[model samples]
Target chain A: MHEEDRQLVRTLIRGDAAAFRNFFDDYFPRLFRFILRRVNGDEESARDVVQSALIRAVRKLDTYRGEASLFTWLCQVTRNELADQVAKSVRQETYMRRLVDLEDDPQARGILESIPAGGEAEPESVRQREDLAALVHAALDYLPSKYARVLELKYMEDLSVEGIAEAMGVTAIAVQSLLARARVAFRDVGETLLPSLGGNW
Target chain B: MDTQPDPRADEPPTDDLARLIRRAGRRPQPDPEMHAAVRAAVEREWSAHASHGGRRGAMVLGVAAALAALAIGLSWYSLHPGAPAGSAEVGTFVAARGPVHVAPTDGHEMVVAGSRLNAGSSIETGPAGYALLTVASVAARLGPGSLLKLNRPGHVELVRGRIYADSGSPSAPPDALVIDTAFGQVTHLGTQFQVRVDPEAMSVSVRDGKVLVSQGGGRSITIDRGQGLRVSSDGEVSRLNVAPYGANWAWVSEFSPNFPIDGRPLSAFLSWYARETGLTLVLRRPVTQADLDRPTLSGSITGLSPAQALAAVMATTQFEYDMTVPGELRIESRATRGAN
Candidate 1:
């Protein structure tokens, strides 16, 4: 794993544009989802944090020693960026104070309670579903990139077995075998990591 | 790895696990525009590192070039002791506004904060441009529509427009500032003064201390504190009394160097406010030295004029200020005020 990441870092530092695009496409979405969940699905804040982190990572690419996988290192950088963003927001307390005031107001609370929740699903079920979705994404992040990518293509993209094979550059039989292992892996990891969300599975 | 193959292997499982896996796909993704912006920024950084063999190497080259320039400047200065100072860094721009440009060589570049300004550089301010620079030991503030050439440390040529120079306090002044104009040369004697060069006349206003305006042929006139001297194109001179602090000096206060108040005491901020406004700071009775030095400030006061910054900083403390007296800022404890 370290050797593979070392090769990727070398390609990135050599200014291989196509290699950079592949690296970006491979990691950016995963990191984005990782941060989005943590930021309570604030897409703008997540984007800002991830964008700054990725740029910072690229600028400091030569420092990658391959001691950890490239994704893990990127996550470390993203965490720092997120921490800085949180600090800046805390320092600008006017907005935070307004939010606190709104939360404290009984009239505002009454108005919020009066508004009907969206969608046909009950609010609790919707929240549970959202939490389960976030947990699944987190579990996928922990999986090997190949396992995560294959699963995403099959389920989220609704890609056929042949399509998954084409995307992964493998034979259909290999795709099928990977999918079987990926599913088992996902279930095992999810059950271990989040029993509440993965209890039924 | 428990690779337990079920009978339903290689097929889509119609179990709760499959539903959850599909739900993960619905997780929020990044916005397309934001994604593209990030990619562009990353690629740009990668290209910079690739082309320059990393920023560290580029920084080394920058430092090496700066050292070589310094060496050449030192050699030139040593060879000609009586000549103007060699082309070396003499000051740094502390603050700038609007379209301030510094022509260090033949071409001009937009001035940025903390940029080193070398000797022989010409600074020009646009109609809305205002700049505050610390040249050597003096702080020079250039107003809009001005063109000033830095000859050397403590000396500058004012081609046109207005410039204010503060050589610090009279008790312990820095290097005296000399402003050469078309009419005559105005040199400060450890003072704070404003020099304005118009098409028809050049005027020197002394806000503090005194300055000597020298016409050619050994003729000179001393302008005392609170006095202004205007010399016409034909060498006609007129003197007038000008207030040290008023609307006339408001523009100078607008572009004053920002006093970083974080972790600084209230007394330090008050002193800065007094100096910037040319007002005498007076702590009224009951406001002891300990009271003024007790509270430490936090946060920034950037982008505010001197007066506005003072008000904002004072509001965070238990002190109240009164500017009712002309050219005096009286500060007292709020508790003292309430008791009175």
Candidate 2:
């Protein structure tokens, strides 16, 4: 929205390669750092998300009305791309579950066993961690989409109550109410699925 | 469904819990090379858009070309079945394992090593069985429980089960490569790919090069290397990125036929090995084409797949190879020559 960024946008849209290169030098590190944190130190994913974000940014530069700082716009693109990746992974997990839902065929389980646990962690520990994460993901899946979205903003994006309210176009009190209900439902689902964790947590 | 927030409890995660959330986001920065590569890609996209007049024009041209290719492939597969394609024999079977059989339109017969197959021949395998046959320079591995019939119109019909096909050498024309499935037609250009057809859905995973996957009526999508698509019977397609050499491809690796490198030029051997393993052989600086051409590798790779064989053999040679991308094999020639 600044006058300076608006001029840069005008230059970028005019097919000025030098201007674009300058923009890349200015923004690549900032964008890469943001995506790196979001992807939990997964360098490969950070690179992919940043590349995709930059490509979209370049292609849609003409449509950039300079309503927000260019970096903010780029971050929004990266967030959407990261969400797409998560949803894709969820779909793959769902598909794999459906593949051998019959009786948990040992042959299929053998294929899954080959997946490395990373670092020096034991396979059993990794499996336990994955199992807990799966349970949490399942609980989240059971919540209404609106409820899940609020919780994701609160937890995953680390947005504040007021920020969540602003993002959801609601009041902070309403956001508080939504978060409380989401947590309760998430707990109920987790309890019905795995009771030991329910009591301990 | 009852929809109401509890009146008694209106709360959020405590400050400590919020700290936990923030901790989740703490991650180390990516490598500088990765950032540079991404920046370069953005520049390339911008240049491409400018060169093609615009992204819209480029996309239109790409879609038009894709549609033309798909139409040709669909017409190729829709030819009459059981018709002989030129001479009866495409090529002789170089290797076969377990109970491999070929059932013609009239009767059934067992397939053996060096046995030639014709258009009417329906190749099959029983439980815990597989077959590897070389049809031209191209090598195809028929996995267990597969039934394949070489069709008349220059395509192989996979009735069901899995087939790993690698059209050897990028120079070899893709004139004879078409895999017909119930869901669609899969054609590739000197590539390594696997087509698995079950009773419910058909999946095509490309390891290298590009594959034209046509679901008929001009509906086709070009799946590039490291990408896979699963098409349900209702023509629903879901794509996933493929790690070609990962555990997901272990079964395919187990079925790879022997690639002899003894008394062969290093270049030819590497090209064949890379093609079979779905790797694009890259020769780095100091490793010229002359090195690939002149060096006559004198070794034996008996039972290993292309990837394993490359590892074991490259250790004995001056060249070192690594998987640079999902399906690329980059060979780096070291400064100190020979096995050091």
Candidate 3:
């Protein structure tokens, strides 16, 4: 956008290491700080995101059409990468939470605590978990791949609607609509069949 | 139609989704070692590119090298190349010199190549080549000199290759097909199974669940638990009732002589013990899935690292298990082994 920025871009395109060094040194801290706020005080994660954005920019240097400012492109890439990581953490949290929920449920907790800690899964309980998982899986299978991917990216990956749209190459509004539709589909299927499978939908 | 309501109506549309999307956009920085490795890779590329001199020459050479690698890479397909009808697409194929492109034929075709296959998409190789294909969600590690074909009706055949099929759940179809030299053609029946095919002996290891191994000449043997089978290429199937501890446990077990527990199942545990103690456990009968999943017996057998602990358990318990080999014990006693 600016003459100086355009010059920097030309230098980077030419593979000038000095230009890259200047760019990296100047922008690295700003990018790190920006990432830090997003990552919620995880210094290591913030550092990771900033470095990744820089490396990606370097790799795809040829693909830069200069349609958007360098800053905008970099920010776009940075957001996508962070969203993917967040989604992973979210999925882990959800799964572990589900496992914990089984232990904390008023009725279930009594049955669970009856056994020693670190003990084997009671056959009945294991069967129940397995059965529930199977029912959930079956319902998941009925949904389209796009919906599944969106749900996974959202709830599992904790990606924002805009982030999903970007990764999926769709409009943010489209993602919103898709999520709405997907929930309806899930809940409809859950109500119709999951209860019959003896699972609380 | 009026009775059908939207699931998302209760939850208002929010901007958090967009924020999450923006957040996921951030890139992940590589570890210091990875950064160093990437730098090294770049340096290597730079050196190779700079060697030729001139910008055009460097660019041309770089592109050529990349294309060649990609072409050599063309031979290998990571996933199930299950011919989903219609015209067969050309997946990657790697060869001795480099990678080649192989398209599926209407009938059978074989291609010879080298280099371990790193990945694939719906691609299966013939028995003549070695590959690791990731079809569907499962990653199947193939042995050298094996013929594997990919078709919709179960990714068809593996004529002679050692394969470890990490087939994804039962809901998903079998991602790979294996025809072991020792055992018969075995489909991925919702579990990880290894088939090793060699001249003197061929064997099948059912890592999880059961594998119905059909012998080449139409006979089939169902091997479950830690059991395996030895069959010749000539189609003579010899059931190896011996618990394949060494073979099964090598990858799955998380224990050692020093640390005691390595997070492997009994199959893996038995395999590791066999390897360490130079003994084999010949089971009088099979262990049930319920027995295996019981957790008490499945995980690391605590204090069993020392012979004293083994003897103590033996002396205290009514469980009848005899040491078939010096260190290997077969559970012959009906009484359950005491919970660890």
DockQ of every candidate structure:
0.16, 0.12, 0.03
Superposed model 3: Cα runs more than 4 Å off = A1-201, B1-131, B144-147, B151-153, B168-183, B199-201, B216-218, B242-340
Quality class of the docking in candidate 1, CAPRI style: incorrect
Per-residue lDDT of model 3, residues B1-340, tens digit only: 1123345533643344333223234333333333323333432333332222222210100001122312222222211122224443322232221111222322223333321221111222221123444544555554423445443333434444455665545454543444433345665667656766544346777655567776545777788756777665455666665444443333222211222434433444444444443355555444453343333332234423334334443343334457745446675435433332
TM-score of 3: 0.27
Instruction: Give the local distance difference test score of model 3.
Output: 0.46
Which consecutive 10 residues in model 1 chain A have the weakest lDDT in total?
A90-99
TM-score (all chains, Cα) for each model: 0.46, 0.42, 0.27
Which portions of model 1 show Cα errors greater than 4 Å?
Answer: A1-201, B1-90, B105-114, B171-175
lDDT of 2 at B35: 41
Evaluate residue B267 in candidate 3 and report its C-alpha lDDT on the 0 to 100 scale: 43
Model 2 off-target regions past 4 Å? A1-201, B1-91, B105-110, B134-138, B169-175, B216-218, B243-245, B280-287, B320-340
User: Ignoring the other chain, what TM-score does chain B have in each prediction?
Assistant: 0.70, 0.60, 0.37
Cα misplacement distance, residue B173 of candidate 1 (Å): 5.9
* Cα lDDT, model 1, residue A153: 84
- The superposed Cα distance between candidate 2 and the true structure at residue B82, in angstroms, equals 15
Q: lDDT by residue for model 1 over A1-201, one digit each (tens)?
A: 598999999988876543565677568888998888777565666788888899899989989999998988999999999888778966336335655777788997986676567765656666677777778888888777778878888887878877875454344666777888888888888988788763777
Q: Write the per-residue lDDT of candidate 1 for residues B1-340, one digit (tens) a residue.
A: 2223344445655567677787656655665446555655665666667533322210000001111211111000001011133457667766655434454432212334566667766666544456678766778999876888878777789988788988777753533678899999998787888988866678888889899999999999999899999887877899989888875576687577767899999889888888888899888997887889889999887667777788899899998999999999999889889898
